[model samples]
Target: YGGIFTPTEAAGVGVMAMLAIAITQGALNWTQLKDSLLQTADTSAMIFAIILGSEVFDAFLARSQLPMKAAEWVSATGLPPFGVMALLMLFYILLGAVMDELAMILLTLPVFFPIVAALDFGLPPEETAIWFGILVLIVVGIGLTCPPIGLNVFVVSAIARDVPITAIYRGVLPFVAADIMRLALVTAFPVIALLLVRLLD
Candidate 1:
């Protein structure tokens, strides 16, 4: 690979290149550009709002030492490693019903990360962290597609006003099922998550 740009910088360069191409092809008109800018602003505002809310919640939890207490309590319970992991996954599924993925992860990582890291997963510390992260993302994806309070469903419903929310939820059932299967595989065999990292190394 050329050392001209870091990965992050490459993303910016790619965006610039796309913009140049669009402009050269007369595909980027003033009205479309204005709409794109407006949409980007709206999305950025929403993301920052989520981050702000999660950070405030995280700060409160830190001040209360709740995560530490919870970790201590879990350790004292004498549950097997897999048993505790199961409970945490269940908790995430329930919590994800109400919170977005980012908020769920940020607010709970303080408590959950330590507990998982302390467990003997037959892998190195870094590998365990990576495996747990993949599992968390899978569960969060499942939660986002579940009925009732699924944040992504709500977002899509807002965009496609003509479609019933129930229909959208139904459409996503296969995806959720697939994610659950992926979660099960990753949970049972951490290697699936770490193989690429190992290969790269």
Candidate 2:
């Protein structure tokens, strides 16, 4: 909250804090610690594999210039800014369904950011960027709860072994709907996204 730590540093601090609390609570036995370390290693390996795969996929897309061509086509259509934005949002949702959220952002931004920056969204350049980011984040979150490839659902399933995968997916449907509504609200009224940023400013 103080903004004194980078994300990686913050994660380290959080782990250390939790470790201290667990020790104080008499919950830091050697067996439990070994199990926790093993679990962490396993989880990290899975995440690393996913990230590596996404990186390879992103590289393939970049080499193919598919995103750039899509952007060029959209630009050629001369659609209204809102129409273009709608299409971009739809594309993001679809892409996010199969792609890692981080990779999705990095792969599309180079093409999409320039397209967005060129359009007049009735907001300052910085504000437009922020609003767009929030929207993408919401969409990515939706994708994360979507079925067949919802990474978050799978991750949760790993932790909650007794819960059926189908049940987990079912549980996330409401969240997906809510996120869609949020995306719509933010898209229709960009100021909703910008309000807090303005307050902070």
Candidate 3:
């Protein structure tokens, strides 16, 4: 509830609140809380390790100079910066069929992030970065509801296997399209993401 705290501190408070609730409800006793803390520590360590590993990998890639070279190649194509971003998103959507979202993020962030960051979208660099991250998250959520590797589809499949997979995919297509439309707005207009802040301020 503190307005001045950074997001990292906010998240820490949120987790503490959840831990407090679990203890109150007896869902997390002393022994269970200890286990949860251990698990959280393990996961957090692995996440940072991945971040550091990815950083080193990004450095290696930069040293090779291929992405910059590729960006130069792309810049020569005369496409708008956001146009290039749209094309990149389509590629991510297609890739979602083959790879899970987190895998795609982990593997490609090192490569694509630098490329996107280098482009000018009239916004500051950090705003562009946040916009692109939201775009990737939206695309991944779409992928989860889609076919070939749809996590939601699989979850629903067992509940309604008699309902043909094709039929389910057909049914969900409109919802997915709606999601795409929403994300398209977010991609094209950054204000939607910041609307709450604008209103509050």
Candidate 4:
């Protein structure tokens, strides 16, 4: 039963539990409650806006057949399988810079997955998917923390208010370096990602 609840539902339940506790303790007055509700509404609105924008952008990409064209081009390239995968990783990094991570994954995977699936990566298709998914996750994480549009950096700056955005970007460099190192290792060694999956089986 617990497994049936989505993350959003779980978060909602948590919020309600906290609210109830606060009320019981008389720690949350009407003013505080109203302010909290207002902030929640604003945050919800921003999330919905992002979702709407992503859907619209995805629709546009689908209509243009960009993914299909890209896959075709990649297939036509004489590069070895690993070379092509490297190119795809680079593409993901660029895409992540401009798009939400979830949006980027949802928009690109339909096309990218098929291309990768056709490649001979010395692993089964399922394992290839797992490995590629992890690689993309790392690349996107790097994008989120990297400069020139690092979403997480801007978000932190926004929240901290006093911390300069440039300083935030500077601080994020070490984490991005670590992410790059991790990405390289995962790309070079599929077993790192497959170990847990194999254990489960």
Candidate 5:
């Protein structure tokens, strides 16, 4: 009946499938179902609250025109394109410390993309977009694992309450270091990201 399976529909289908399998195995009971539902509801509520808070904060930032002003200042610096990109990466790391990853990206992309597009990156617009996107994703992924507000770390800590949050943060440091190295490699060699795109083309 539907032309495409939306995410909500897909999630509903998955739940139904799991319920059917559990019933066939006689593994599910009313108590378990109730517990699962309660957990799901709690998780969903937390996620929604975070998203709502981020959206409101993002709107405030936008109204202040901070991103656009920052972009303008960067452009006026007379720095090379690579220098500009490096500065933006640093800014993203700081922003990610306080902002949700999705909210940060949606908030900054409009201001940053125009500056990037105007620079002489020597690649076609589409290729540049892909390369920039991968770089941004890498930086954001690092942010989600880094200190002070690593969203991934917090989520893990919440689930594994027996494990100290400090321990979890310590365990994640090596991976975060590796991510920084990978980000540097990709920034130096755009081909690392575009190789598959080129191959498919």
Candidate 6:
């Protein structure tokens, strides 16, 4: 039988194997590893900047009391479990149309999460939070590929200005449909998002 190792041990072993492979390929050198680490550091730094920027606005939203009011309104509605979920998805989708996904999640989740937790969704609060988060992410994904203001679509167009945005949108339509199907399944079942959480036990 094959034996397993701790993740740290496996990663150490993998790094050693990578060094051996690079040596075999005639590319192993202190300079090459240093360059790779520098590149990784640059990428990580860019990501950290965005996270920090979003957190700044996220903190403001919590301090304003608006999120708590929204949560209160949601709880007062007494909507059915599925209806409550649908409303949350729609709310996130419409918000995604104008707001950045990271900022919206960081800000709105604090408000909306309390509302969700108060409901009797036949699931634990933690599971409801995770499930709702997955739906919110799916909704924001549409904005990533949408035209007029899609950041990803704009990035693609900037690189190839000759190609019309229409073409890109058309090209991405099928993928959007696939995404919708994935969202529907996850929304309907909820288990898709919770499998790992369930499995860890």
Q: Top TM-score: which candidate number?
A: 2
lDDT of each: 0.77, 0.84, 0.72, 0.80, 0.84, 0.71
Task: Give a tens-digit lDDT track for model 3, residues 1-201.
Answer: 668679989998889999889889888888877887886776566546544554565456457764456546655677888888887777667655545566657766777888789888887776777778888898878876766656566546545658987888898899889988998898889878766645775
- Which pairs of residues collide in model 6? none
Model 5 clashing residue pairs (backbone): none
lDDT of 2 by residue, 65-138 (tens): 87788888888988899989888887777777677788778878888988898999899999999998888888
Error of 5 at 85 (Å): 0.9
**lDDT of predicted model 6:** 0.71
Off by over 4 Å in 6: 1-77
Off by over 4 Å in 5: 1-15
Predicted candidate 6 versus true structure: per-residue lDDT over 104-144, tens digit per residue = 77777777776777777678878887787778788788756
- Winner by TM-score between candidate 5 and candidate 2: 2
lDDT of 5 by residue, 1-201 (tens): 364678889889889999989978989988998998898788667656765665787788778977778778888999998899988888888777667887788888988998888887788899999999999999998887789777777777756769998999999999989999999889878899999999999
* Candidate structures ordered by TM-score, highest first: 2, 5, 4, 1, 6, 3
Q: Over all chains combined, what TM-score does candidate 4 have?
A: 0.80
Compared with the true structure, model 1 gives a TM-score of 0.68
Tell me the lDDT of candidate 5: 0.84
Each model's Cα RMSD: 4.3, 2.5, 8.0, 3.0, 3.3, 6.3
Poorest lDDT segment (10 consecutive residues) of candidate 3 = 49-58
> Over the stretch 22-58, how does candidate 4's per-residue lDDT look in tens digits?
9999999999999989977776666566556656766
- Name the lDDT value of residue 197 in candidate 2: 99
